[model samples]
Target: MRFSRILELGCILAGLFSGAAARPQDELVTENSSACKNPPKRVEWRQLSTTQRKQYLDAVLCLTKKNATSGITGAVNRFDDHQAVHSSQTPSIHWVGHFILWHRYFVATYEKALRTECGYTGGQPYWDWSLDAQPANLSSTKAYSTAIFDPTTGFGGNGDYMQPSVEQNPLNITGNTGGGCVKTGPFIPSAFTVNYPTPDCLRRDFIPWIINSFADPKLVANVLAQKDYTSFARAIENVPSFDQPNIHGSGHFGIGGVLGTIGSAAESPGDPLFYLHHANLDRILWTWQQKDLQTRLNQVGGPITPFDYSGKNVTLDFQINMGRLAGNATLKNLLNTTGGTLCYTY
Candidate 1:
């Protein structure tokens, strides 16, 4: 197992994550932020120094070297713990009322793990796709040329040509350029391992067209112009079949590949880029919420079920959890980034 290769780090993860006694459900997690007095500010990926970028990658590597608390077979390391939980919760979290709330909490939990477990001191960085998806840049190569895909400082570039073993949903979506294993970057098959849903290389078929189509500045502005949370969520997440793809799908399909674990929606976190991608999404959500915090912060209304717009609306008190990673939290606490268990700003 990956964790066994790093004994000392394994001890750190075990003592910190597994060896602790169970606490009451009401206990605060990560840090009980007394205030956002000096909350760490998140920056765009380019804003970070090359050294800072390397440090962030190192923390992610450390996660892979640590033992997973979840004994599930596919969860070979601590990193896979997230993959397992996300895959399990996909149906409940996405397309629902708490989609934004639950993901906000999930990303915060990951930031905490990076800091407390892996000794990464920097705040999380986001990948702003808008800059790359501009109309002039939409000529196909602009988004693909981003440094975020750099083999050295970034996650890596496109995978080679190969066929997908299993066909997932959203059949209408087109443009999958590469399907083979990633040949370069920090997470090439030789340097990194992804064991969920059977071991495989981190693959990415970069369909820059998808990014250009959905994440253009005009579309993003449209999403932000939404009058309420429900409209905003639908604008970003779009419908179940992804017929009307949104920014969220832009990032996912733009990267364009089954992950190292090799699954689309559910198995996305298997790739390290998932966090950076989602961090940017969360930043957009936060940006929209700040327009009128009094109303937007409290405003949330969508179906309780995935793709079921006519179903019951999930309330603020709806519960979300990350198994042992973050026990449980409510949509209420997750609404305000700085006020709840979260204490970060973008």
Candidate 2:
């Protein structure tokens, strides 16, 4: 067999037998040793030139017009698949070790859908909240007030709060300050409607307090600095030591209004911000993976399953389900975005 083929086989075997017994650390393949591979340049949202950003948005808009692949009856358009997939798998993927890998897969495939289906030429852009998490400028961060939120040039600011309180579980959380349809953005109902017909807007209640307190740059750095995967994942998701919400959750709250759909966790994908937020998360993971390439790439942490939902114990070999949007996927295949079926970098 070719060396690349051999390495691929090794990854599969390692994932399969990982839980049964310990394997030599040096035995696992690090990355594909392909001689010629094109690296994908995934830039930050802010770094994108006006044309690039518009192209990216145009592609996203294009996707909203495509038919859904999730097979859910009544579901329409590719964008709907995002909400459908996330809703069905919410129980198994969130609040677990698989959080990172599962989301990585979700965002990657979504990006792929954009390129293949909608002819998006650029890689997905990420929202690095840390840059905007500065104490002195929390209230004025460009993340919410700048071009990214421009009604014509950006996704638009908060929702218009046209409807009553939306009921999000765990807490009957009210929609953000606006709580209505997005009155100022490109995704307004007249221009583009959601999969399901709803009177509510794409709401967002920008909570500077949450961004300052939970999504702090220092806190995010500390979360990334953890030497082990479990600690890292927990800090981003649970942050047991602090009374504040998890860093990941903080981003949702920060952009939430009618965008509160993002706060829903399961329905967050309903909002376009979900991909940008997750791309940022994926960038963090990619950055961490680059530190000690071999070990970090193969390192799988936390339970294979969600702690609150299914009781199944996760093994390193666990296969992540992507619903009808993707074929069989595994952590091994997802570990290195530049390897295997993945070939992009941030």
Candidate 3:
């Protein structure tokens, strides 16, 4: 599993160097008297009250029944558009300088879809993996608690041991821990279905060792301390050697099985947790930006093309398409949460 996963990551990284590559308030409510008015709050998953969690979950489930316009042949609901968007543009967006900006727009668009299509009122929430990455209490973090895994309020726990195994990649990391469908949680096949029309359940196989080892406080501190975008992006997306420690990939690797799809170059959005993971990622970047907001806001680098041998800066006008999920948006417009259509903070 180690070698295969590492090799898979190497390909992603090679495509990246390649490209390149935060937390804030519980409720990020910012009102600018000079420019814009009130901005909504994007809270933490743990911070959400039971009621808020239910509301959010209900709306998320509701998206499954809503139709999609992304043009992916088998798409079933609005949620499918998101998955389709991620799948279609995965190559250009991932491991590129546009990874952050493109995903920022993608996440924000999903939030907008929730509100517009499902009548959801609250802003999107993020998961803070660092809180659970502590050494002493790593085994019992809230990330694996009933609060997060309960069938009623949580997304559900790992897949049942009897479920079919995930197809092994070429390197043969031998799929994740659990292979069967998710038997517990609101996402059980009997209770809910994914918009992308998968026959399997929402499986998860939490790899405690990954989080305990790679996602430690020290690693988080190292990533946070990076001075420039290049080193910072490379550190987080650490390719070349998948064995190298990286805080960004920790969450994805920590939750293996179907949930591990986040590690897939594409098709990651199929997992509902993708947004939360990316939201937290955005928060980290936002925190880094806060250290030098004036300069960081305008800072951009990395390769224009995934396979570029020569390092080149990503342009502001880089185009990203989302089909009917949302209109095409440029990397520049997606850069600032405060400027352009984006108004909320982490």
Candidate 4:
């Protein structure tokens, strides 16, 4: 068999076996040829001290080299291509498919890279928003609550009560003003709502709700109100999949708008969190695969034509070379595999 064919077969087999056992270190491979291990539980966000945060951030920085950037671009191109082919006809189906494929590769590849490059040995940690769902649990410094919701500061505007904006306003006047300025909010006692014409449109204001929903029931409801990761995936699975105005269509607008706005406004690489946010979005797809393994695995779909942006038909294929997106070794190899070297546990 040809090498590519053999690789494809291996990937299929790996995907079938992914759920069978606890992931072992040897199953993962990196450029360094060393085994990767799971991260320590204490490495979670709340547990990290100031020094640890600095260390972790520095390590993450080192791992995100120029080459890593290129690899990410490649992954994006693949995604763009897939979307163009499949979404045009059945948008919802296409997006859910896109989510699953993209996240499977992302988590697998990034985990391997973290293990081999930064000596990071744990599973990826998620920011749970359940802790601050209630008005009382929010802290001045850590948790967002009525006490810290600042209109002038961190993403959202100040005070427990502030003026809300129209749902269509992408500037996030209630959260992220212009580009850099963010307003902080103190936790509100009410169940979070993302009503149209309320600055909460598109769920931008729900970031705090998402951050606090991990362990809190009320917070989970708040996050759910804005379509938590699971609901987002389910929305894709539901009929009229792509047309679901709230998630996929809005998601495209959100991502495309940010790219356009940030590209025009700054010379620096937009937000570092851009990739991380996408990564989390990708993780939702991974979780979906775990839930409906057979149905998800049997699928084979992509876009029909490349997207037309500013009159250009963007190319989508593995052959095209993207600058920072092309160079990352882990991402480069991941495009062709179901899970590649690493198996996802959670």
Candidate 5:
């Protein structure tokens, strides 16, 4: 048998035996890797000191204040450049083979911009939203009430309350609590603006049901239990329904308003929290990969065409394009978070 076939089979077997174990530091990714001499450690949003949080927010704002460096003709700021890349290639990237790997690269590039361009000193931070969606708080998830929405210290609170008026792709947003523009928080009209499909307020409609029912810890644990790389990817990307709630999609709907509305599901990068949100998903993918790193670090499978399971299977050599932000990279280079092109760990 060819090495690729042997490798693919190994990944399937490892995942079958690897249950949804809690994320661990079983083997340090960059500890002995020569390619990454000093990898940055990604932490949870709440782990950052007040100063670190302030720095991250400031770096994001700095991108907003600068002019675009890419050829995205519609973009107005450095930050908009990233979304322009996403907005154009939105459909091709999601519900496809490259979904998780592509987003991991995209978020890492954004993080690099935050550090290299905006002078952010620390690595990227992820928001473990499940902590706020535990069973105890299942009835009324601690989503909107947490410090993550602190007007002074965190991303601002819910937009002015507006009844739900949306139903998109996989999930329904009828239970949204805020639909108007965000009036508080760092990205409010006074402080931030998004320029894609036209300039608009950064809106958020914290849906407790999304948290209580869809994005709760149980969904995450379930996704982690999948028996293979392909199965895990399919599970994570499942559209939410009464029987199944997508952990990945739930994060977006949980912050419903404009992030959910713009581009169906593509232009989420318009919201500043998009990076933090994606970082957590990457963390989940990374945790899943860590459980069987030997097999998983090289294991990637799914269709090349978005939502077309019958299409050609994407291989490790498939090229993922990111426009001008980070240019093109192969699926193999992005497989491992540490020694490959990426250099960070959660």
Candidate 6:
């Protein structure tokens, strides 16, 4: 089937769950009482037992698969069915809205799965980044009631760059800074050289607060259940990005990029932080939705066109469904943010 036709069917499914009939794709969505809330109690990562961590990972993987499949299918179905009559003039207000809705559902679904499937009792936690700016000794990972990092036992080591400066000597001969160059001296290093290259080249010499700190685990559940846009926006704005780039060409490398990368190490995704980082990004987008209801309805600031890795442009009409890339999902089913039979609370 054509992409557009598939998306049309998906949209129909999404709308059916959302309690809305086929209508303009750009319509403003009415806030559902169950979709937003306050932050929840935080939980520390170190506090979690191995079993708990494994269960959380399992739940996250399942939820991601489910949403990705549904989202892609819906997108493809919508595109295939609406190709002929759809026009460029049609407003694209639903981009962010759809993004937000699906993401919230994504997080909530995982939280639910964790609770129901694996007997998870703790809530989702938030990592705070601002705390990393403090002085070394004074910086306590335990400052937040829900701190995820324990400074005393954290992995990055004690020193600022995790240890003494490698650039202390140029010609020490024991180490090289870069480009296969070695120097020997008790020399005051030039602008580019380092005596201890290993420490110098290390990323996360001092771990950031977000990775180390934790927020109330209930935050995800609360946000999903209430409509407090103020806190929601704050949380969204605070998500941190690492140094490495991903297939998407955005985000940080080691810390933030870790989860998103896929494939082997020689040419691997280049980071383990990718998935977790995107999950946080998705959370922020969801927060933006409740904060900016008007703009979402108007299709303001949506992507002009979807692009592939080679920079080729792809049309995003109602007919462009998700099934092509993500199996049986379609676009039509994703139009409405609420009204699905399986509703989730943060």
Query: Which prediction has the highest lDDT against the true structure?
Result: 1
What local lDDT score does residue 54 receive in model 5, on the 0 to 100 scale?
Answer: 89
Give, for candidate 1, the lowest lDDT window spanning 10 residues: 1-10
What TM-score, to 2 decimals, does candidate 2 have? 0.82
lDDT of each model, Cα atoms only?
0.73, 0.66, 0.64, 0.30, 0.72, 0.28
- The reply for model 6, stretches above 4 Å from the true place, is 1-116, 121-146, 149-276, 294-301, 304-342
Instruction: State every prediction's TM-score relative to the real structure.
Output: 0.87, 0.82, 0.82, 0.40, 0.85, 0.34
- For candidate 3, write residues 89-183 as lDDT tens digits: 55566556777777777888898888778988888888877776755664544456636566778677776543333444343332345544567
Candidate 6 structure quality by residue, lDDT tens digits, 65-158? 2322223222222111111111111122122223333333333343444455455566553233222323243234333222222222221111
**Taking the tens digit of each residue's C-alpha lDDT, what string does model 5 give over 1-346?**
0111223333333232122232223223222356665678899889999988889899999999888975666789989988877766665676778888989999999998998899997889988888877545644857777777778778887777755433222233355577667787688888888786477787777767666666678878988888777778878878424355677765676776323332134347887778887899899999998888888878888888756788897888777766667656678778787764677887
Error of 3 at 11 (Å): 14
Worst 10 residues of 5 by lDDT: 1-10
Error of 4 at 118 (Å): 3.3
Off by over 4 Å in 1: 1-37, 136-139, 163-173, 241-243, 257-263
**After superposition, candidate 2 runs with Cα above 4 Å error:** 1-36, 134-143, 161-176, 196-200, 239-242, 257-259, 308-313
Give per-candidate clash totals.
0, 18, 5, 53, 1, 86
Better of 3 and 5 by lDDT: 5
Model 2: per-residue Cα lDDT over 131-155, one tens digit each? 7665566455445675677777778
Q: Cα deviation of 8 in candidate 5 (Å)?
A: 34
State which candidate, 3 or 6, has the greater TM-score.
3
- Candidate 4 minimal-lDDT segment of 10 residues: 260-269
Question: Model 6 lDDT vs. the true structure?
Answer: 0.28
